[model samples]
Target: MTAGSVEVVLRRAGAPDALAAADVWLRSFAAALPTVVSPRSGDDVRQYFRDVVVPFRETWVADAGGGGGIVGVMVLRDDELSRLHELSQLYLDPDWRGRGIGDRFVRLAKERGPEGLDLWTFQVNKPAHRFYERHGFVAVEYTDGSGNEEREPDVRYVWRP
Candidate 1:
């Protein structure tokens, strides 16, 4: 699709979009972290949606629109770190990467008026690190998890608004 032709909308996610959003998340993350973990099955993905995402619809899926279908999804939660918003998940379909959709979602999250924003990324995810940095996020801490649980260090980044 042409640059201006992409019609992306930002809104709260509902029940109907939950499964699809999970699919997007699974596919996106699997592609982005193939070496770290095994690909997620549909059932696992669905459970993840039901458990981690569906229960918290308020701050999740701030943007859920694109050309062919919903190409992006973001999951956020209030941080315990004082007015900080934790961006738990931000996934764009592989085909939709570099289209500014992720950036727009970040902007939308900021527009929602949180005091600060934070997210975690795998150390090997250089592209994602650059993406977060480009959007004004700075590294604050590093730990281990990254869904691998065996290897790879996860770095946390934060942005204050």
Candidate 2:
């Protein structure tokens, strides 16, 4: 999709794209969660996507137009809430982070989601907070570290359109 001045294609991913998508996801996660100890290695993340995420969720990838392989991925879990889709994961290669690709992802969610969308991110991810805020998402809830696997405080943001 044309996100700003760039033309990246966003489409459903099949079995073949899993590995590359997982690598991008993992890299984004590791960089975004540097303080979290025991970050999963790239192999482990790929396995998780192949076994857990792909089997249970909808996966999409962003192609970098020039045949360069995927630079972004998004995993969605629909109906997690009564009327909202849960944005399970959204990651972009560090090289592509500041570009408007992320704004493109947010727009895709708004257009394709049933009614609204929700997502969770670590409370310390202030940059994410700003990004979401700029996209019209509002913080709705906060949770202590106990419930999540990483045991890190988290915030939930919801967007309705």
Q: How many residue pairs clash in each candidate?
A: 0, 1
lDDT of 1 by residue, 42-90 (tens): 7987887877686664434534344456677888777776667778789
Give the worst 10-residue stretch by lDDT in candidate 1: 57-66
How many clashing residue pairs, candidate 1? 0
Pairs with steric clashes in candidate 2: 1-8
Cα error of candidate 1 at position 100, Å: 1.0
Cα error of candidate 2 at position 151, Å: 0.7
Best candidate according to TM-score:
2
Clashing pairs in 1: none
> Per-prediction RMSD in angstroms?
2.9, 2.2
- lDDT of candidate 1 at residue 117, scale 0 to 100: 84
**Model 1 lDDT at residue 95:** 76
lDDT of 2 at 96: 82
Query: What is the TM-score of candidate 1?
Result: 0.84
